[model samples]
Target: MDMTIDAIDARVVPPVALAYTKALTLPHLASAVRPRFLVLQPNGSLNQANSSDFQHGLESILEQATDGVIVDLLWVGSLDAYGIAALVAGIQRATALGKQMLFQALDAKSRLALEIEWAQQQESSVGAWKHTFSSNLEAFLDNFTHG
Candidate 1:
Protein backbone atom coordinates (compact mmCIF):
# COMPACT_ATOMS: atom_id res chain seq x y z
CA MET A 1 0.00 0.00 0.00
CA ASP A 2 1.03 3.59 -0.54
CA MET A 3 2.26 5.10 2.72
CA THR A 4 2.17 8.73 1.60
CA ILE A 5 -1.06 10.72 1.29
CA ASP A 6 -1.02 12.75 -1.89
CA ALA A 7 -2.17 16.32 -1.66
CA ILE A 8 -5.02 17.43 -3.87
CA ASP A 9 -5.58 20.73 -5.60
CA ALA A 10 -8.76 22.13 -4.04
CA ARG A 11 -9.76 24.22 -7.08
CA VAL A 12 -10.43 21.08 -9.03
CA VAL A 13 -13.21 19.41 -7.04
CA PRO A 14 -14.61 20.40 -3.69
CA PRO A 15 -16.31 17.09 -3.04
CA VAL A 16 -12.93 15.36 -3.09
CA ALA A 17 -12.07 17.57 -0.15
CA LEU A 18 -15.37 16.74 1.49
CA ALA A 19 -14.94 13.00 1.00
CA TYR A 20 -12.33 12.79 3.71
CA THR A 21 -13.71 13.12 7.21
CA LYS A 22 -11.53 16.11 7.97
CA ALA A 23 -8.99 16.37 5.14
CA LEU A 24 -8.30 16.00 1.39
CA THR A 25 -5.05 14.10 1.71
CA LEU A 26 -5.20 10.94 -0.33
CA PRO A 27 -4.63 9.75 -3.86
CA HIS A 28 -3.11 11.30 -6.98
CA LEU A 29 -3.61 8.36 -9.28
CA ALA A 30 -5.12 10.34 -12.10
CA SER A 31 -1.84 10.42 -14.02
CA ALA A 32 -1.36 6.75 -13.49
CA VAL A 33 -3.80 3.93 -14.13
CA ARG A 34 -7.15 4.04 -12.45
CA PRO A 35 -7.01 3.41 -8.75
CA ARG A 36 -9.01 0.41 -7.69
CA PHE A 37 -8.94 1.17 -3.99
CA LEU A 38 -9.22 3.96 -1.44
CA VAL A 39 -7.86 4.34 2.09
CA LEU A 40 -9.89 5.83 4.93
CA GLN A 41 -7.88 7.45 7.72
CA PRO A 42 -10.14 8.19 10.65
CA ASN A 43 -8.53 9.87 13.64
CA GLY A 44 -9.25 11.43 17.04
CA SER A 45 -11.67 10.07 19.63
CA LEU A 46 -14.21 7.72 17.98
CA ASN A 47 -17.03 7.97 20.46
CA GLN A 48 -20.58 9.24 20.12
CA ALA A 49 -19.25 12.69 19.38
CA ASN A 50 -17.79 11.64 15.98
CA SER A 51 -19.02 8.18 15.10
CA SER A 52 -21.61 9.79 12.84
CA ASP A 53 -18.88 11.54 10.87
CA PHE A 54 -16.95 8.32 10.66
CA GLN A 55 -19.98 6.46 9.40
CA HIS A 56 -20.73 9.20 6.94
CA GLY A 57 -17.19 9.06 5.66
CA LEU A 58 -17.40 5.30 5.31
CA GLU A 59 -20.65 5.50 3.37
CA SER A 60 -19.51 8.28 1.11
CA ILE A 61 -16.14 6.71 0.43
CA LEU A 62 -17.76 3.44 -0.44
CA GLU A 63 -19.86 5.25 -2.99
CA GLN A 64 -16.76 6.89 -4.41
CA ALA A 65 -14.65 3.74 -4.46
CA THR A 66 -14.71 1.40 -7.42
CA ASP A 67 -13.35 -1.81 -5.92
CA GLY A 68 -12.38 -1.67 -2.24
CA VAL A 69 -11.33 0.38 0.76
CA ILE A 70 -8.69 0.01 3.47
CA VAL A 71 -9.62 1.76 6.72
CA ASP A 72 -6.55 2.75 8.71
CA LEU A 73 -7.25 2.58 12.43
CA LEU A 74 -3.82 3.64 13.67
CA TRP A 75 -4.54 7.29 14.45
CA VAL A 76 -7.72 6.77 16.41
CA GLY A 77 -7.25 8.09 19.95
CA SER A 78 -10.03 6.11 21.55
CA LEU A 79 -12.83 3.75 20.51
CA ASP A 80 -15.89 2.42 22.26
CA ALA A 81 -18.23 -0.50 21.61
CA TYR A 82 -20.32 1.69 19.36
CA GLY A 83 -17.33 2.50 17.23
CA ILE A 84 -16.51 -1.17 16.97
CA ALA A 85 -20.07 -1.97 16.03
CA ALA A 86 -20.00 0.68 13.33
CA LEU A 87 -16.94 -0.90 11.78
CA VAL A 88 -18.50 -4.35 11.84
CA ALA A 89 -21.72 -3.10 10.33
CA GLY A 90 -19.84 -1.05 7.74
CA ILE A 91 -17.87 -4.10 6.62
CA GLN A 92 -21.08 -6.08 6.29
CA ARG A 93 -22.59 -3.29 4.24
CA ALA A 94 -19.53 -3.21 2.02
CA THR A 95 -19.81 -6.93 1.42
CA ALA A 96 -23.44 -6.49 0.52
CA LEU A 97 -22.48 -3.83 -1.97
CA GLY A 98 -19.86 -6.16 -3.50
CA LYS A 99 -17.02 -3.97 -2.30
CA GLN A 100 -14.19 -5.02 -0.02
CA MET A 101 -13.58 -3.35 3.36
CA LEU A 102 -10.22 -4.21 4.92
CA PHE A 103 -9.14 -2.97 8.30
CA GLN A 104 -5.60 -1.60 8.26
CA ALA A 105 -4.65 -1.95 11.90
CA LEU A 106 -1.01 -0.97 11.62
CA ASP A 107 0.00 -1.15 15.31
CA ALA A 108 -0.39 -3.72 18.03
CA LYS A 109 -2.90 -1.66 19.97
CA SER A 110 -5.25 -1.11 17.04
CA ARG A 111 -4.85 -4.69 15.90
CA LEU A 112 -5.69 -6.05 19.33
CA ALA A 113 -8.71 -3.83 19.74
CA LEU A 114 -10.11 -4.71 16.30
CA GLU A 115 -9.30 -8.40 16.67
CA ILE A 116 -10.98 -8.63 20.04
CA GLU A 117 -14.07 -6.98 18.68
CA TRP A 118 -14.03 -9.13 15.56
CA ALA A 119 -13.63 -12.27 17.64
CA GLN A 120 -16.79 -11.50 19.50
CA GLN A 121 -18.63 -11.15 16.18
CA GLN A 122 -17.04 -14.28 14.72
CA GLU A 123 -18.90 -16.41 17.22
CA SER A 124 -21.98 -16.07 15.02
CA SER A 125 -20.27 -16.19 11.61
CA VAL A 126 -17.02 -16.48 9.66
CA GLY A 127 -15.27 -15.02 6.65
CA ALA A 128 -11.88 -15.24 4.95
CA TRP A 129 -8.72 -13.28 5.79
CA LYS A 130 -9.69 -10.44 3.46
CA HIS A 131 -11.00 -8.39 6.36
CA THR A 132 -7.43 -7.40 7.35
CA PHE A 133 -5.00 -5.34 5.28
CA SER A 134 -1.27 -5.95 5.09
CA SER A 135 1.64 -3.68 4.22
CA ASN A 136 2.58 -5.85 1.30
CA LEU A 137 0.26 -4.53 -1.37
CA GLU A 138 0.78 -7.49 -3.66
CA ALA A 139 -0.14 -10.07 -1.04
CA PHE A 140 -2.92 -7.98 0.40
CA LEU A 141 -4.45 -7.45 -3.02
CA ASP A 142 -4.21 -11.13 -3.75
CA ASN A 143 -5.95 -12.02 -0.52
CA PHE A 144 -8.49 -9.23 -0.63
CA THR A 145 -9.48 -9.52 -4.30
CA HIS A 146 -9.44 -13.29 -4.41
CA GLY A 147 -9.86 -16.35 -2.16
Candidate 2:
Protein backbone atom coordinates (compact mmCIF):
# COMPACT_ATOMS: atom_id res chain seq x y z
CA MET A 1 0.00 0.00 0.00
CA ASP A 2 1.35 3.41 -0.98
CA MET A 3 1.18 6.15 1.62
CA THR A 4 1.78 9.86 1.27
CA ILE A 5 4.29 11.49 3.58
CA ASP A 6 1.68 13.67 5.26
CA ALA A 7 -0.65 10.73 5.58
CA ILE A 8 1.81 8.55 7.50
CA ASP A 9 0.67 9.85 10.88
CA ALA A 10 -2.82 10.96 11.79
CA ARG A 11 -2.21 12.91 14.98
CA VAL A 12 -0.11 15.80 13.66
CA VAL A 13 -1.75 18.97 12.48
CA PRO A 14 -1.32 20.95 9.23
CA PRO A 15 -1.52 17.75 7.17
CA VAL A 16 0.74 16.77 4.28
CA ALA A 17 0.38 19.82 2.07
CA LEU A 18 1.14 22.26 4.85
CA ALA A 19 3.85 20.04 6.30
CA TYR A 20 5.61 19.74 2.97
CA THR A 21 5.38 23.50 2.48
CA LYS A 22 6.91 24.11 5.90
CA ALA A 23 9.61 21.52 5.33
CA LEU A 24 10.72 23.25 2.17
CA THR A 25 11.78 26.23 4.27
CA LEU A 26 14.06 24.18 6.51
CA PRO A 27 17.64 23.22 5.78
CA HIS A 28 18.08 20.31 3.36
CA LEU A 29 21.24 18.57 4.47
CA ALA A 30 23.17 16.19 2.28
CA SER A 31 22.82 12.49 2.99
CA ALA A 32 25.84 10.30 2.29
CA VAL A 33 23.45 7.43 1.72
CA ARG A 34 21.08 7.43 -1.19
CA PRO A 35 17.34 6.77 -1.67
CA ARG A 36 14.89 6.88 1.31
CA PHE A 37 17.49 8.69 3.43
CA LEU A 38 16.58 12.07 4.88
CA VAL A 39 19.47 13.99 6.44
CA LEU A 40 18.74 17.06 8.54
CA GLN A 41 21.42 19.47 9.70
CA PRO A 42 20.02 21.81 12.30
CA ASN A 43 22.27 24.83 12.87
CA GLY A 44 22.83 26.97 15.98
CA SER A 45 21.20 25.96 19.25
CA LEU A 46 18.59 23.20 19.46
CA ASN A 47 16.34 24.37 22.24
CA GLN A 48 12.59 24.47 22.84
CA ALA A 49 12.06 27.27 20.33
CA ASN A 50 13.89 25.52 17.49
CA SER A 51 13.11 21.95 18.42
CA SER A 52 9.51 22.13 17.26
CA ASP A 53 10.71 23.01 13.81
CA PHE A 54 13.24 20.24 14.02
CA GLN A 55 10.65 17.75 15.17
CA HIS A 56 8.12 18.80 12.59
CA GLY A 57 10.77 18.63 9.91
CA LEU A 58 11.68 15.17 11.04
CA GLU A 59 8.08 13.99 11.04
CA SER A 60 7.45 15.49 7.66
CA ILE A 61 10.51 13.82 6.21
CA LEU A 62 9.63 10.53 7.82
CA GLU A 63 6.31 10.54 6.05
CA GLN A 64 8.17 10.48 2.77
CA ALA A 65 11.02 8.17 3.67
CA THR A 66 10.99 4.43 3.05
CA ASP A 67 14.28 3.41 4.71
CA GLY A 68 14.94 5.85 7.61
CA VAL A 69 16.16 9.26 8.69
CA ILE A 70 19.54 10.68 9.72
CA VAL A 71 20.02 13.75 11.87
CA ASP A 72 23.57 15.05 11.49
CA LEU A 73 24.72 17.20 14.40
CA LEU A 74 27.98 18.39 12.86
CA TRP A 75 26.66 21.96 12.52
CA VAL A 76 24.68 22.06 15.75
CA GLY A 77 26.54 24.22 18.28
CA SER A 78 24.47 23.49 21.37
CA LEU A 79 21.66 21.16 22.38
CA ASP A 80 19.78 21.36 25.65
CA ALA A 81 18.09 18.57 27.63
CA TYR A 82 14.78 19.42 26.03
CA GLY A 83 16.39 19.21 22.61
CA ILE A 84 17.88 15.85 23.46
CA ALA A 85 14.52 14.65 24.69
CA ALA A 86 12.90 15.86 21.53
CA LEU A 87 15.40 13.90 19.47
CA VAL A 88 14.84 10.84 21.61
CA ALA A 89 11.10 11.12 21.14
CA GLY A 90 11.57 11.49 17.42
CA ILE A 91 13.77 8.42 17.32
CA GLN A 92 11.24 6.44 19.29
CA ARG A 93 8.49 7.54 16.97
CA ALA A 94 10.50 6.42 13.97
CA THR A 95 11.40 3.13 15.55
CA ALA A 96 7.78 2.39 16.44
CA LEU A 97 7.00 2.69 12.78
CA GLY A 98 9.78 0.22 11.96
CA LYS A 99 12.09 2.86 10.54
CA GLN A 100 15.59 3.85 11.61
CA MET A 101 16.45 7.23 13.13
CA LEU A 102 20.19 7.65 12.98
CA PHE A 103 22.02 10.56 14.62
CA GLN A 104 25.45 11.07 13.13
CA ALA A 105 28.51 13.32 13.15
CA LEU A 106 27.87 14.73 16.59
CA ASP A 107 30.20 17.49 17.69
CA ALA A 108 31.91 17.36 21.09
CA LYS A 109 29.31 19.59 22.69
CA SER A 110 26.34 17.78 21.19
CA ARG A 111 27.93 14.47 22.12
CA LEU A 112 28.38 15.67 25.71
CA ALA A 113 24.82 16.92 25.90
CA LEU A 114 23.44 13.63 24.61
CA GLU A 115 25.59 11.67 27.08
CA ILE A 116 24.57 13.84 30.01
CA GLU A 117 20.90 13.71 29.12
CA TRP A 118 21.04 10.01 28.38
CA ALA A 119 22.71 9.34 31.72
CA GLN A 120 20.07 11.40 33.43
CA GLN A 121 17.38 9.37 31.69
CA GLN A 122 19.04 6.15 32.74
CA GLU A 123 19.35 7.35 36.32
CA SER A 124 15.68 8.23 36.34
CA SER A 125 14.86 4.80 34.86
CA VAL A 126 12.76 6.28 32.05
CA GLY A 127 13.04 7.77 28.57
CA ALA A 128 13.72 6.76 24.96
CA TRP A 129 16.73 4.80 23.78
CA LYS A 130 18.64 5.08 20.53
CA HIS A 131 20.13 1.94 19.02
CA THR A 132 22.01 4.07 16.51
CA PHE A 133 23.95 7.17 17.44
CA SER A 134 27.39 7.37 15.87
CA SER A 135 30.43 9.58 15.41
CA ASN A 136 30.19 9.34 11.64
CA LEU A 137 27.71 8.57 8.88
CA GLU A 138 29.79 5.69 7.54
CA ALA A 139 29.68 3.93 10.89
CA PHE A 140 25.96 4.54 11.21
CA LEU A 141 25.39 3.00 7.79
CA ASP A 142 27.78 0.13 8.38
CA ASN A 143 25.54 -1.30 11.11
CA PHE A 144 22.93 -2.26 8.52
CA THR A 145 25.62 -3.70 6.26
CA HIS A 146 27.23 -5.79 9.00
CA GLY A 147 23.94 -6.94 10.43
Candidate 3:
Protein backbone atom coordinates (compact mmCIF):
# COMPACT_ATOMS: atom_id res chain seq x y z
CA MET A 1 0.00 0.00 0.00
CA ASP A 2 1.18 3.50 -0.83
CA MET A 3 0.21 6.76 0.88
CA THR A 4 -0.87 10.12 -0.44
CA ILE A 5 -1.88 13.32 1.33
CA ASP A 6 -4.60 15.35 -0.31
CA ALA A 7 -4.37 18.85 1.08
CA ILE A 8 -7.65 20.32 -0.06
CA ASP A 9 -9.20 23.72 0.30
CA ALA A 10 -10.16 24.20 3.96
CA ARG A 11 -13.66 25.40 3.15
CA VAL A 12 -14.71 22.36 1.12
CA VAL A 13 -16.33 19.34 2.74
CA PRO A 14 -13.97 16.37 3.11
CA PRO A 15 -16.21 14.10 1.05
CA VAL A 16 -16.46 16.46 -1.88
CA ALA A 17 -12.75 16.84 -1.99
CA LEU A 18 -12.43 13.11 -1.60
CA ALA A 19 -14.48 12.60 -4.70
CA TYR A 20 -12.36 14.99 -6.70
CA THR A 21 -9.20 13.49 -5.34
CA LYS A 22 -10.42 10.01 -6.13
CA ALA A 23 -10.96 11.02 -9.69
CA LEU A 24 -7.37 12.14 -9.86
CA THR A 25 -6.43 8.84 -8.27
CA LEU A 26 -8.45 6.59 -10.57
CA PRO A 27 -5.50 4.98 -12.28
CA HIS A 28 -4.14 3.92 -8.93
CA LEU A 29 -7.48 2.60 -7.73
CA ALA A 30 -8.09 0.68 -10.90
CA SER A 31 -4.72 -0.94 -10.65
CA ALA A 32 -5.54 -2.01 -7.10
CA VAL A 33 -2.75 0.19 -5.79
CA ARG A 34 -4.15 0.72 -2.34
CA PRO A 35 -3.06 3.84 -0.56
CA ARG A 36 -2.77 3.42 3.19
CA PHE A 37 -3.89 6.94 3.93
CA LEU A 38 -5.61 9.82 2.17
CA VAL A 39 -5.49 13.17 3.98
CA LEU A 40 -7.95 15.87 2.99
CA GLN A 41 -7.62 19.55 3.88
CA PRO A 42 -10.57 21.61 2.80
CA ASN A 43 -10.24 25.34 2.28
CA GLY A 44 -11.52 27.75 4.91
CA SER A 45 -14.66 28.64 3.02
CA LEU A 46 -15.91 25.88 0.75
CA ASN A 47 -18.95 27.08 -1.15
CA GLN A 48 -22.25 25.78 0.26
CA ALA A 49 -23.59 24.62 -3.08
CA ASN A 50 -20.40 22.70 -3.77
CA SER A 51 -20.61 20.90 -0.45
CA SER A 52 -23.84 19.09 -1.33
CA ASP A 53 -22.54 18.12 -4.71
CA PHE A 54 -19.32 16.89 -3.16
CA GLN A 55 -21.16 14.60 -0.75
CA HIS A 56 -22.97 12.89 -3.56
CA GLY A 57 -19.82 12.73 -5.59
CA LEU A 58 -17.84 11.16 -2.77
CA GLU A 59 -20.47 8.50 -2.20
CA SER A 60 -20.22 7.56 -5.81
CA ILE A 61 -16.46 7.42 -5.67
CA LEU A 62 -16.42 5.21 -2.60
CA GLU A 63 -18.63 2.75 -4.36
CA GLN A 64 -15.76 2.14 -6.75
CA ALA A 65 -12.97 1.97 -4.19
CA THR A 66 -11.36 -1.30 -3.18
CA ASP A 67 -12.63 -2.91 -0.01
CA GLY A 68 -10.55 -2.78 3.20
CA VAL A 69 -8.53 0.17 2.05
CA ILE A 70 -7.70 2.27 5.09
CA VAL A 71 -8.25 5.96 4.42
CA ASP A 72 -7.27 8.68 6.87
CA LEU A 73 -8.94 12.00 6.14
CA LEU A 74 -8.12 15.33 7.78
CA TRP A 75 -10.05 18.58 7.71
CA VAL A 76 -8.14 21.76 8.40
CA GLY A 77 -9.67 25.23 8.61
CA SER A 78 -12.22 27.45 10.30
CA LEU A 79 -15.61 26.89 8.78
CA ASP A 80 -19.11 28.24 9.23
CA ALA A 81 -21.59 26.49 11.55
CA TYR A 82 -23.47 24.77 8.78
CA GLY A 83 -20.23 23.92 7.04
CA ILE A 84 -18.93 22.26 10.16
CA ALA A 85 -22.12 20.20 10.44
CA ALA A 86 -21.79 19.01 6.89
CA LEU A 87 -18.15 18.10 7.44
CA VAL A 88 -18.93 16.21 10.62
CA ALA A 89 -21.62 14.19 8.93
CA GLY A 90 -19.33 13.41 6.04
CA ILE A 91 -16.56 12.28 8.37
CA GLN A 92 -18.94 10.22 10.48
CA ARG A 93 -20.28 8.40 7.51
CA ALA A 94 -16.80 7.67 6.22
CA THR A 95 -15.78 6.37 9.63
CA ALA A 96 -18.82 4.15 9.86
CA LEU A 97 -17.74 2.66 6.58
CA GLY A 98 -14.25 1.92 7.93
CA LYS A 99 -12.27 5.07 7.26
CA GLN A 100 -10.10 6.76 9.87
CA MET A 101 -11.19 10.35 10.29
CA LEU A 102 -9.29 13.27 11.83
CA PHE A 103 -10.10 16.92 12.25
CA GLN A 104 -7.67 19.78 12.75
CA ALA A 105 -9.27 22.90 14.12
CA LEU A 106 -7.15 25.72 12.79
CA ASP A 107 -8.51 28.89 14.37
CA ALA A 108 -12.23 28.71 13.96
CA LYS A 109 -13.36 28.50 17.55
CA SER A 110 -17.04 28.73 16.63
CA ARG A 111 -16.73 26.08 14.01
CA LEU A 112 -14.82 23.83 16.35
CA ALA A 113 -17.55 24.27 18.93
CA LEU A 114 -20.15 23.21 16.42
CA GLU A 115 -18.05 20.21 15.41
CA ILE A 116 -17.88 19.10 19.05
CA GLU A 117 -21.63 19.47 19.41
CA TRP A 118 -22.28 17.45 16.29
CA ALA A 119 -19.79 14.83 17.42
CA GLN A 120 -21.55 14.57 20.77
CA GLN A 121 -24.81 13.79 19.04
CA GLN A 122 -23.20 10.73 17.49
CA GLU A 123 -20.88 9.85 20.34
CA SER A 124 -22.31 6.45 21.14
CA SER A 125 -22.30 5.33 17.53
CA VAL A 126 -18.96 6.83 16.58
CA GLY A 127 -16.89 5.36 19.37
CA ALA A 128 -15.49 2.61 17.16
CA TRP A 129 -14.12 5.23 14.83
CA LYS A 130 -10.63 6.68 15.08
CA HIS A 131 -10.35 10.44 15.45
CA THR A 132 -7.39 12.74 16.03
CA PHE A 133 -6.42 16.38 16.30
CA SER A 134 -3.13 17.63 14.91
CA SER A 135 -1.52 19.75 12.22
CA ASN A 136 1.46 17.51 11.71
CA LEU A 137 1.47 16.01 8.25
CA GLU A 138 4.59 14.02 9.06
CA ALA A 139 2.72 11.91 11.58
CA PHE A 140 0.21 10.94 8.95
CA LEU A 141 3.05 10.10 6.60
CA ASP A 142 4.60 7.82 9.16
CA ASN A 143 1.41 5.81 9.52
CA PHE A 144 0.93 5.75 5.81
CA THR A 145 4.35 4.28 5.22
CA HIS A 146 3.90 1.64 7.90
CA GLY A 147 0.41 0.68 6.80
Candidate 4:
Protein backbone atom coordinates (compact mmCIF):
# COMPACT_ATOMS: atom_id res chain seq x y z
CA MET A 1 0.00 0.00 0.00
CA ASP A 2 1.16 3.52 -0.73
CA MET A 3 2.11 5.36 2.43
CA THR A 4 2.31 8.76 0.80
CA ILE A 5 -0.61 10.54 -0.80
CA ASP A 6 1.63 12.43 -3.24
CA ALA A 7 1.80 12.66 -7.05
CA ILE A 8 -1.92 13.24 -7.41
CA ASP A 9 -2.55 16.70 -8.86
CA ALA A 10 -4.61 18.80 -6.53
CA ARG A 11 -5.51 21.24 -9.30
CA VAL A 12 -7.04 18.71 -11.63
CA VAL A 13 -8.76 16.73 -8.94
CA PRO A 14 -8.69 17.37 -5.22
CA PRO A 15 -7.49 14.35 -3.29
CA VAL A 16 -9.30 13.09 -0.23
CA ALA A 17 -7.20 14.79 2.42
CA LEU A 18 -7.18 13.18 5.85
CA ALA A 19 -4.93 11.42 8.32
CA TYR A 20 -5.28 7.68 7.83
CA THR A 21 -3.56 4.41 8.74
CA LYS A 22 -4.56 1.71 6.23
CA ALA A 23 -4.87 1.86 2.46
CA LEU A 24 -6.27 -0.69 0.02
CA THR A 25 -4.17 -2.31 -2.71
CA LEU A 26 -5.58 -4.56 -5.39
CA PRO A 27 -3.92 -6.62 -8.08
CA HIS A 28 -3.46 -5.05 -11.46
CA LEU A 29 -2.24 -7.15 -14.39
CA ALA A 30 -1.38 -10.01 -12.01
CA SER A 31 0.78 -7.69 -9.93
CA ALA A 32 0.09 -5.94 -6.66
CA VAL A 33 -0.32 -2.30 -7.55
CA ARG A 34 0.01 0.43 -5.00
CA PRO A 35 -3.23 1.20 -3.24
CA ARG A 36 -4.82 4.41 -4.44
CA PHE A 37 -7.48 5.24 -1.89
CA LEU A 38 -9.83 8.09 -2.66
CA VAL A 39 -11.75 8.47 0.53
CA LEU A 40 -14.04 11.36 1.53
CA GLN A 41 -13.36 12.30 5.13
CA PRO A 42 -15.32 15.01 6.85
CA ASN A 43 -13.20 17.93 7.94
CA GLY A 44 -14.03 19.10 11.42
CA SER A 45 -17.72 18.23 11.92
CA LEU A 46 -20.47 16.82 9.74
CA ASN A 47 -23.69 18.67 10.28
CA GLN A 48 -26.23 20.86 8.52
CA ALA A 49 -23.61 23.54 8.08
CA ASN A 50 -21.27 21.63 5.76
CA SER A 51 -23.59 19.13 4.16
CA SER A 52 -23.57 20.87 0.81
CA ASP A 53 -19.80 21.00 0.58
CA PHE A 54 -19.53 17.39 1.61
CA GLN A 55 -22.16 16.35 -0.85
CA HIS A 56 -20.49 18.22 -3.73
CA GLY A 57 -17.07 16.82 -2.98
CA LEU A 58 -18.45 13.31 -2.62
CA GLU A 59 -20.29 13.51 -5.91
CA SER A 60 -17.18 14.79 -7.63
CA ILE A 61 -15.12 11.98 -6.22
CA LEU A 62 -17.66 9.41 -7.34
CA GLU A 63 -17.77 10.95 -10.79
CA GLN A 64 -14.00 10.92 -11.25
CA ALA A 65 -13.37 7.50 -9.76
CA THR A 66 -12.70 4.68 -12.18
CA ASP A 67 -12.99 1.72 -9.83
CA GLY A 68 -15.07 3.41 -7.15
CA VAL A 69 -14.62 5.42 -3.94
CA ILE A 70 -13.89 4.72 -0.27
CA VAL A 71 -15.53 7.03 2.26
CA ASP A 72 -13.61 7.23 5.52
CA LEU A 73 -15.87 8.07 8.42
CA LEU A 74 -13.43 7.64 11.25
CA TRP A 75 -12.71 11.32 11.77
CA VAL A 76 -16.25 12.54 11.66
CA GLY A 77 -17.01 14.08 15.05
CA SER A 78 -20.76 14.03 14.66
CA LEU A 79 -23.55 13.29 12.22
CA ASP A 80 -26.89 15.04 11.97
CA ALA A 81 -29.95 14.65 9.81
CA TYR A 82 -28.51 16.91 7.13
CA GLY A 83 -25.28 14.98 7.09
CA ILE A 84 -27.23 11.76 6.72
CA ALA A 85 -29.19 13.23 3.86
CA ALA A 86 -26.03 14.31 2.06
CA LEU A 87 -24.49 10.89 2.53
CA VAL A 88 -27.58 9.21 1.16
CA ALA A 89 -27.60 11.52 -1.82
CA GLY A 90 -23.99 10.76 -2.59
CA ILE A 91 -24.63 7.01 -2.40
CA GLN A 92 -27.72 7.28 -4.54
CA ARG A 93 -25.79 9.24 -7.17
CA ALA A 94 -23.03 6.66 -7.14
CA THR A 95 -25.53 3.88 -7.61
CA ALA A 96 -27.19 5.71 -10.47
CA LEU A 97 -23.80 6.23 -12.10
CA GLY A 98 -22.85 2.57 -11.63
CA LYS A 99 -20.00 3.38 -9.33
CA GLN A 100 -19.18 1.47 -6.14
CA MET A 101 -19.09 3.42 -2.90
CA LEU A 102 -17.38 1.81 0.08
CA PHE A 103 -17.63 3.29 3.56
CA GLN A 104 -15.07 2.21 6.14
CA ALA A 105 -13.60 2.74 9.59
CA LEU A 106 -16.83 3.89 11.18
CA ASP A 107 -16.65 4.30 14.94
CA ALA A 108 -19.42 2.79 17.06
CA LYS A 109 -21.40 6.00 17.33
CA SER A 110 -21.07 6.77 13.65
CA ARG A 111 -22.01 3.22 12.73
CA LEU A 112 -25.15 3.34 14.84
CA ALA A 113 -26.16 6.66 13.37
CA LEU A 114 -25.69 5.39 9.85
CA GLU A 115 -27.54 2.19 10.62
CA ILE A 116 -30.50 4.13 11.90
CA GLU A 117 -30.50 6.35 8.85
CA TRP A 118 -30.22 3.42 6.48
CA ALA A 119 -33.03 1.61 8.21
CA GLN A 120 -35.25 4.60 7.65
CA GLN A 121 -34.45 4.47 3.94
CA GLN A 122 -35.51 0.88 3.58
CA GLU A 123 -39.13 0.19 2.79
CA SER A 124 -39.07 -3.52 3.67
CA SER A 125 -37.86 -5.68 6.53
CA VAL A 126 -34.91 -6.69 4.39
CA GLY A 127 -32.01 -4.36 4.97
CA ALA A 128 -30.87 -1.83 2.43
CA TRP A 129 -27.54 -2.37 0.69
CA LYS A 130 -24.68 -0.88 2.67
CA HIS A 131 -21.11 -1.17 1.43
CA THR A 132 -19.13 -0.88 4.60
CA PHE A 133 -15.89 -2.33 5.92
CA SER A 134 -13.68 -2.32 8.97
CA SER A 135 -10.89 -0.82 6.92
CA ASN A 136 -10.10 0.27 3.38
CA LEU A 137 -7.71 -2.63 2.94
CA GLU A 138 -10.40 -5.07 3.93
CA ALA A 139 -12.75 -3.64 1.35
CA PHE A 140 -10.15 -3.90 -1.41
CA LEU A 141 -9.11 -7.41 -0.50
CA ASP A 142 -12.69 -8.58 -0.39
CA ASN A 143 -13.94 -6.85 -3.51
CA PHE A 144 -10.99 -6.59 -5.88
CA THR A 145 -8.14 -8.92 -5.06
CA HIS A 146 -8.27 -12.61 -5.94
CA GLY A 147 -7.05 -15.02 -3.36
Per residue, candidate 3 scores C-alpha lDDT tens digits across 1-147 of 122334332344562323344222433344444434444344334346455544453443344443322223234333455555555666666666775444444455754665686668677665646665575776887889998
TM-score of structure candidate 1? 0.55
How does candidate 3 score on lDDT?
0.47
Predicted candidate 2 versus true structure: per-residue lDDT over 1-147, tens digit per residue = 011122222244443332223233433324532235555556667788777767766775765566777776766777777788778767667877788887778767766777776577565766656676556876768877897
In order, what lDDT does every prediction score? 0.61, 0.61, 0.47, 0.60
Q: Once superposed on the true structure, which residue ranges of model 4 sit more than 4 Å away at CA?
A: 1-37, 124-147
Worst 10 residues of 4 by lDDT: 1-10
**Candidate order by TM-score, highest to lowest?**
4, 1, 2, 3
Number of clashing residue pairs, candidate 4:
0
lDDT of 2 at 16: 34
Supply the global lDDT for candidate 4.
0.60
TM-score of 3: 0.46
TM-scores for all candidates? Answer: 0.55, 0.54, 0.46, 0.55
Misplaced by over 4 Å in model 1 are: 1-34, 106-147
Span of ten consecutive residues with least summed lDDT in model 3: 1-10
